[model samples]
Structures are given as structure tokens and as C-alpha cells.
Target: MTPAIYSPDEIARRIALFERIRHPHKLLSEIHRALNIVRAEVNQSRADMVEFAKQNPGMTIKPSPLPLICVIGPSGTAKSHVIKTYYEDVCRTENWQVGRRAVFDFELSVDANKRQFHVDALTALKDPDPEKGNESVLRRRFGKLTDKLGTELGLCDEVQHFIASDTGKRTKSVIDAMKKTLNTGICALGLFGTQKAADIFDASEEFGQRAHIRFDLKGGNPDVADDRALFVAFLKTFKTEIEKMGILISTKTLEDAETIGCLFLQASGRLGLCQRIMKAALRVALESGATTLLPVHFAVAIDRGKLLFGIKENHFASHAEAFAD
Candidate 1:
């Protein structure tokens, strides 16, 4: 494809528009609802502690554990995207102190253990010397930082890494640390990962009991009528979104049933992958100086993304057939 000689400003403007467009998803609402519930519980817990402290000065207060919210999904389900979006929204809406952070999100490393977990948590909290302290000291620092930063939530991403083959001791240590944090009454916890994480949560009676709300992000089944309808509707809505961003899409091709089916197969019915493919398609269309985003642009994007994402097939590619009736 020949590159169009676009001004730097025009390219930036197009990129900004692409970044701003987001497909609305129902799972976002579920996450919001869970956050609201946890927030309410934390606020009440804080208020109760204040009242109790007033009544009994210099007395220790042990608060009950707050409920956890687990966001379980496969890769490309946008678990992190939705959580980060909510975190950004919170940062904007909340009038906290300048240096204080609201949400601390950290992904677990492959060599995840009790010590590394605390180190990662502290790092996410912006602790200046996360690796300098011992495990006990690091855990204490994490708790102190969470309290000081007025953190409302702590998100643990890719938690499956934390669960080792010897789940007895190692898993218990990490789980105990999380339970200790919850017991500290500093911040609510939210876990995000694939189905393996969900299985771990389910297997652990403590985590299972505490995590009453679990949001599962699953891909759509193309054979299912309702699922197919939802996927088609999402594409139509995206057409409107791109048009609003001043990118004209070929209406006839975009609205065609066969084209939509090809899109569904290429995207594997995952919204994250679908959006990524579309963004790549937009870039292809822009570079090619296409007046409108055509099916061929999407096909090229699918082929490119197939290699990038390790997708086995490119349904939109010319060699592939349309969805079978």
C-alpha cells in the first residue's frame, strides 16, 4: 500500500480519534456496580472505626474483611482495559490529594511468591525502595502506603502466576498475605485473570466465600443467534463511532451479512481483538489514501493481526470462505 502524504497534525488527529472511540460493553457496568458496593462497604467501615475510636480512645479496632471482586476472562477479553478505564474514571472524579493514587494495579510475575508479591504491590504503590526491604517489612510498607495514599482498591492481575505447583505452602502464603491486607481495612481487592485464576478462586474456600461478585468475560459464539446479533450490532455501532471520528466506512460492505460474518470469524468474537483489528484496518485505510474503509482494508488488517496475535486463521482473507449458513 502506498503511503498517503498526510501532514503530521492530520495523522495525530486521526490517531487521537481512534484512541477516543470505545465500544460500550455490559461488563463495564458490572465492574462499576462491584466497585460501588465495595466503596460503600469501605466507607462504612471507616466511619464505624472513627465512631468507635471516639467512644474508646487508645483501643485497637479490628474490622471484618471486605468482599473481593474477581474479574475472570480469557486473553483478549479486555479485563485489564475495563479495569484501567474504571481506574482512570475514578482518578478524574475523586478529589483526592495531589500525590495520592486511588487504584494500585499490578500484574504478578512468573516467579510469583509471597516476597515478590509484596514487592510488586509496593512497586505499583510507587514505593521508592520496593526491593530494599524484607518480606515482612515490605508487606508492612505496602499496608502503610495503601493507607497513606487513600487507596480505594488494589487490583491483582494475572493471579494465576501466584499459584504454584505446590499450592499448599506457597499459595497459602500469598493468599494469607491478601487476606491480611483485606483484614487491615486499607483497601478493597479486585482480582483479574483468565479461567485459571477463576479456578483458583473457586478452589480456595476463603477466596470463594469472600468473592461474592465474579464477572466473567466470555467471547461470543457465532452459531448462537443472540450472540451473533450482539456482535453484528457492535460492528454497526462501531461504524457510527468511526464515522463520528470522520472516517467514512463503505456502508454497503460494512452492513453486508457476509462481511459481518467474516469480521466475526477474524475477531474470534472477542471485542478486544475486534477493536484492535479495526484500529489496524483504519491505519491501513489511512495509509492507502482510501476514501472509505473497505472490506479489503479489513482483510489486510486481519492478515497482519493474524501474525501479530498468533491467530490461526484469517477469515476475512481472500483465501478463506465466508461463514457457513
Candidate 2:
């Protein structure tokens, strides 16, 4: 028999059912709610930033809304995770509005020629001509589209791609166009990248001063104790939920899992990595027909992640050092 081809409505219903089942502890629910709050705040901030930029376009120096937050840190400091987490919290506070505005991640890339940078800004605002190729046409229509929809745009990822070349006229023009669009206040932009990327902006006095908030993750600051604690709590909660599903994870194994998790965080600072580790561990345990998660399961998960991330198992220290802090 052929498999059923589900309609969108059917697919949505199935998704809802799965969410309710898998997230009985409300972890996914909380994440959804948090995203909503972040969306609203991002919309408001975007509008405010656009207006401020337009009002003082010619001003060599001007203040921005709060500190334009620039998350700067090493490769594995979880800079992206921090931004995403904050965005989720903002969304949750707003109760996850059905039609509310939101901020989104942006990405930048360069072509093989490397002469120009690409800025892909994700927005809830409808694109009048989703197929429009002309930058001018998009800009002129973007304002009307955003005004009518009351939606906002968000930018993230490769923020450095938005910066135009200092000497090239075309590059400058492109950058100016982006700046003007941002000034319209339709959405707030959030940038997430490595320290080197942040340095690209810092090197330019014009862009450097525009950043309102700078979060440095490499200072060896002890203040992250709270964040670390929260992460540990999240892990414990996740482990409990898995156990309730009839998966028994031993205490020793859980400690080992946590140790591996901390190392992943230290290397990539990506929460996605942490989740992958957990999922892999659970899958391996299930495959073995074992009710409990064992050390081997964690070891397998860590090895899998390391391979995917192009890193080595030896790169991470043992749990002894992780627990010491």
C-alpha cells in the first residue's frame, strides 16, 4: 500500500498531537511562548531604530536604541544560543500571539568572486514582489508592505556581509540602501557571529559606534555561573522527561552525559549541539533495548557530534574538570 500524502491541515494536526505528547512537561510550549515575546520586542525595536536612523541620517554620530547588542565571543561560547534564548524569552512573555510581529535571523554570504556581500534578512513583512530582482523596487515596496501588515524584520548570522567595502561605490551604495531600509523601523536586527566577525564591525569606526550593546563571551568572566546553572537545570529536567518515557538513565551515566555536554558548549557554544548529543544518546539507548542510558550511549553521542562538528574526542577534557567548576 502506498503511504498517505498528508495535506497541510492534516500535517499541522499531526504536529500538534506530537507536540502535546512529546512536550507534556511543556518544554516546547515554553520555547514557543518565549519566541513570541522576542518577536514583539524585536518589532518595536526595529521601528524605533529605523525612525532614529532616518531622523539623524546625516549626523556623523548618534545614539541608538539601547545598546545595539553585539554578541562577540570565541567559536564555542554559545553566542548564537544566547541570542536565540533571549529571543525565546521575549516571545514567551508575549504569550505567543497568533498574528503578532516577530524578529528573525539573517545571514550573509559571499559569492565565489568575493566582490560583494549578500544580506538575507528574514521578515514577517510580505514581499510585494517576492520575485523582484531590482533592489530599488524591493525597497520602495517594503515600506508599504510592512506598514500594511504591521510586521517586523530581523537580521542575524553573517552580519559582516552587510558591511559595504570602504572604497567601492557599488558596495557603498548597497550598504546605504540597507541602512535606509533599517531606518524605516520595520524590524530590529540581531547579529550573531564569531569574534572575528564582530571585529570587522569594530574596525570600522562608523559601524563600531553604532553598536549599542556588546556581549563578550571570552573574558573568562565568572558571571556566567547563573547561565551555567540554568543549563544544568535544563539538562536535569530533560533527563527526567526522558525517564518518564520508560528510559532509565543511570546517575553515573547522566553525570558523564553532562560532562560531555559542557565540553560541547565550551567548544561551539551552540545549544543545538547539546540537543543533538541528548537525542543521539537516547536513540542509542533505545536501539540497544535497554531501559537505562549507559556510559557507552553518551560516549557514542559525543563521538557522533564530534565527527559532525569536525572535532576530535580528545579535544574535550574529562568530567573531572567539568565538575570542579
Candidate 3:
């Protein structure tokens, strides 16, 4: 039997449904606020760096000529969460009065292959002709955009394939052209990726040196006194917020969550994972037809560490058995 092909109308309807289902305005708003907070943090970080630079005038580091920052860490480390929160916060703070804020996220994962990168970036910039159907014309148009923005266009992602190790000469030329626009201070680039992404910057001495500041989320370990207190505080605060929303969590559930959080901290002590745990617990509660999450809810939420962290399912299963018992 032949597979059914979607007709044009069916395809359009599916697209509409997908957009409606996937695009949650409220969630997007929340995400926007989160990102703005991150941007503010980035700005503050930049300011602090500038002051530090002044104190050490001869320091090898220079001002981040481009607003590009590479957030690197293992999976479930909260790199994406941090970036999203920062982006939302930045947009909120900037758009408060004037309502003029421009923020966009370019997923390098989708365009990690050749041809797609150019298409994605150009389409994002709303280039008149993204096809590069006319190189000279496209360049002129891009130049105008840079001149107007007064800064280089920014790009964000885990690892940009455009700058991959095996990129060819032609690809390099395209990337170089993009870099030239940035060189004139018309754009600022931001990068988000896993620890392996460091190699991308390491590939080029210039890019490597550009990324000077680093933030790594160390999982808060309960065995460690400081981390224990932090974990408790995080859980307690989360509980309070959920309770305020008419959800009351049982002490047993809290204890279970604590155990889970500690296990996570022991394995991958990133705050990002902590947040996800809480998020998962809340989701489980909602799914169980209970306004408050109880121990069972947490149990339901704990599926190895897949829903916990990004740990392998089998590995997490062993750990989960130990924790569940």
C-alpha cells in the first residue's frame, strides 16, 4: 500500500493546527520576560567586566566587540533555561515604557547543515533576497541593515554548523562575509551550546579569546552543607509559589523531591536540572487530577533521570530503583 500524501489544503490545515497547538501566547510572554531578565544580567555582567577591564588596563581581554556569549555546559545543565530567562527579562525591561524591544532566537540545531544556515539567517533578517540569488544586491541590503541597527546582527544557538570544524572554503567565505558585517560594530552575536561547543571557539584563536566570561551551573549537592541549604531554599520557595496557586504539597512529597534533587545534584549538580525537577513535579501533579503534588506525584515524575536530567534512561532507571526503594 502507498503512503498517503497530504493534499495542499490538508498541509495548510496541519500547519495552522501545529502553530495553534505549539504557540502558547502566555508561555511565550513568560518566556519573553525570562529572556529579558537574562539580557539584563548579561548587560550587568558586561558592565562589571568593563569596570574590571579598567582596573586591569593591560588585561588581554577586550570589551565583547560583539554581544556574543557562548553558554556551554552538559545537557540539562540549564543553559537554554538561563538564555530564555535572560531573553525574556531583557525584552520586558526594554519594552516597559517605549514598547520597542527586538529579540529573536535562531536555533543552530535545525540549520546545522549547509545551505540551511544562510537561508535561516537571511530569512530572519528579512533580507529582500535570501536566495543570494544576487550576491552584490544581498550584500548591499545586509550592509544597510547593519548600518541602521548600529550593531552587528546577533546569532544564538548551541553550536552553529556554519562554523563547524569541517566547514569548506565556500562556507568559510560566507561566514567571513557575515563576520565583516559584525566587525563594523553593526551586530552583536550570542552563542549557546554544550561544553563540546568550546571546540568551535578553540578552532579560532580570535574567537576563543573573545569568549572570556563563563558561567557553569554546578549541581547543588546535599552532602555539601552550602549546596544542601541552597537546595532546600529552592524547594521551599517553589513550594510556596505553587501553594499560592491553590496547590498544597505534602511534606512527604517535599521530602521525595528533596531526595530526587539531591540525587540529581550528586549526578549533575546544575541549577537548571533543579528547576526542571520542580517543573516536572508540578506537571505530574496537574496530570494526576490533584491540585497539590504528593509523594506519588513525585514518584510519577521520576522516570530514571530522563525527566530529571538528560541522563541515560537505563542509568537513571538503576538510580531510580535505588531512590524509590
Candidate 4:
């Protein structure tokens, strides 16, 4: 029997998902949602594989490999924060007991060779002198450690290091090294990088095909209501977090649609930029001994930020309008 081809609607739906994973500027909540989805999927995959193994006794069961989740975004979008938070949380008992590892995290290097990559992984996995071994030995040791650790997930950060702008290029060797390090047929990989690292995956058909969970994250888009609402939620979270450090501000203002919209514009819809603005305002409040943050404080903070960040040309001239009089 011939295989059934997907209809146009199905194909379009698939393409939409593809594009969603490819586009950056995703909100933090969205990224968290994606990670949770990945966790559940890995769990189910583990369960199914165990069941299959029991039923088939002597047979080799090939569980579907988890997709490599490439968290890609611009520099200021809090991509590192997202990856770090998620990665650390995933490294605990549940993942490990399920024969899944929260792989040690390492930053990729531009000048790094394959041997060096292995050495880095081995070190992250707790091997003191991974540099002592050659590629073959390192690979064996690395694989052994992973098995011992019961790690199913591997994380590589700063993947943009593999993209060399000086030569205007990305090398296939680095890509292959990534595959070898994370996907050596034992571990599922999660990579974190900027657009350049994402390019590495898009250009390589083999990598792209396997990277089913590519998460392109960015700051919220100002024009999108859902985006703004999510950012406001993040602001509320920030308020709660900051209060733990003895500073409390009214995130209640963020609840106002007009106020939040203008703040979002000033931030250019980027959470990092929003944090910078708020943190600067917090500093001003700290110095003034003011516990309640007012619109005027944020306006001054925004101006100061323009000079400090060399973003004078993009000043928020009318941001004071967001102030609740």
C-alpha cells in the first residue's frame, strides 16, 4: 500500500509549527511551556520503551529519540536565563531515575576541535582530566559516564561560538562534533545560542531533521496583545522576586492596559530591556528611600538608560504618558 500524503491543511498546520519554532522573540512563559512539553514527551517515550522491552524480552527496542531543543534568540532576550533555569531544574532525580540525564552544561568555543569538545563534556560529567585521552578514548569514557549518570539530556550553550564571523562561516566539523557529543546514540541534546547557532541547524539537513523542538525565543512583540499580557505577567513575577531582596514596587501599575502598553513599547518588547529599565528605576528608588515606585521615577530611569546604553536615538520621549496621574 502506498503511504498517505498529508492534505494541504495538514501541511499548512505543520508549516505553522515549523515557523513558530523558527521565529525568535518568544515570551518566557512560552519557553517554559515548550520545555514542559519536552519533559512530558521524554517521560512517555521512556515509559513506552520500558513496556516494549518487557514484552519483547530479547529484542532491541529503539525508542524515538527526543528532539534537540535549540533555544535561539537575540543577545538581550534572556535566552541564557531561560536555558539555565530549565536545565538546572531538569537535572534532578526524576530525570536521572528515568534513565535520563540532565547533561552537564558547557559553552562551545570557536577554536575548539573535536577532541577539545569531548574533553569539555567529560569534564562536565565529572572527569578531571578529560584532556588526557584521544578522540576514541574520550568518546568511550564520555559514553560510559553518561550511562553511569543515567543522563538522557545533554546541554551545550554559547553555540554561536561555532559561527566564525571573521571567515564569514560555520564549519561542519563543529556541527558534527555537536551531534557526536550529545546525540552519540545515547543522549538527546539541547543547545542554546543566538541566530548564528540556529543557522548551523537550518543549513544542515541532517541536524534540522532531528531538531524537532527548536525553540526560537525573543522579547514580546508590542503589537501583539498576547505578547503584552505575558510580559505584564513577567513583570509581576519580577516584582515578587525583587521583594525577596527587600525592595518592593507596585506591579499593580502594570495591570493597567495603557500603562503596560507604553512600558512594553519603551522596552521594545524585550524582557531584558524591561528588566534593565525597572532595575534602574529600582536603584533610583533605593537611593531616594522611596518604597513606592512612581511613573516619574521610571521616566527618569528611562532617560538615564538611554545615555548609559548608548541608545539616545531611541529615547522614549512620550513614555511619561504611561504615568498614572
Order of models, best lDDT first: 1, 4, 3, 2
Instruction: Give all candidate RMSDs, comma-separated.
Output: 3.8, 9.3, 11.0, 14.6
lDDT by residue for model 1 over 72-188, one digit each (tens)?
Answer: 888777887877687666556877678787677898877577898888888888889999878889888887898788777888899888666654566667777778778878688
- What's the TM-score of each model vs. the native? 0.88, 0.59, 0.62, 0.68
The regions of model 4 sitting more than 4 angstroms off are 1-66, 87-101, 165-170, 240-246, 249-262, 294-325
- Model 2 gets an lDDT of 0.48
For candidate 2, give the lDDT of residue 95.
Answer: 62
lDDT per model, in order?
0.76, 0.48, 0.50, 0.63
Ten-residue stretch with the least lDDT total in model 4 = 15-24
Model 1 gets an lDDT of 0.76
Model 4 residue pairs with clashes = 25-217, 25-218, 26-218, 100-152, 101-151, 101-152
Off by over 4 Å in 2: 1-67, 74-88, 92-100, 109-119, 122-128, 160-178, 218-234, 244-252, 256-272, 315-325
Q: Which regions of candidate 3 deviate over 4 angstroms?
A: 1-67, 96-103, 110-118, 125-143, 149-155, 160-178, 221-224, 247-252, 255-267, 304-309, 313-325
For model 2, residues 18-110, the per-residue Cα lDDT tens digits are 222221223334433434454456556656657877897865443233223455555554555555554555545646455554454545554
| lDDT (tens digit, per residue) of candidate 3 on 1-325 | 3323445564344333322211122333453443344455545545676789889888846344543455566766656665555544454455533322245556653334444544455566666666664555555555465445432235466564445446545335444554553453334555666666666554565655655344444455557887666556645665555554333334234446546554454345555565555556555445434544554444445563464455443222333343344
Q: Candidate 3: lDDT over CA atoms?
A: 0.50
Worst 10 residues of 3 by lDDT: 18-27
Better model by TM-score: candidate 2 vs candidate 4: 4
- Judged by lDDT, which candidate is best? 1
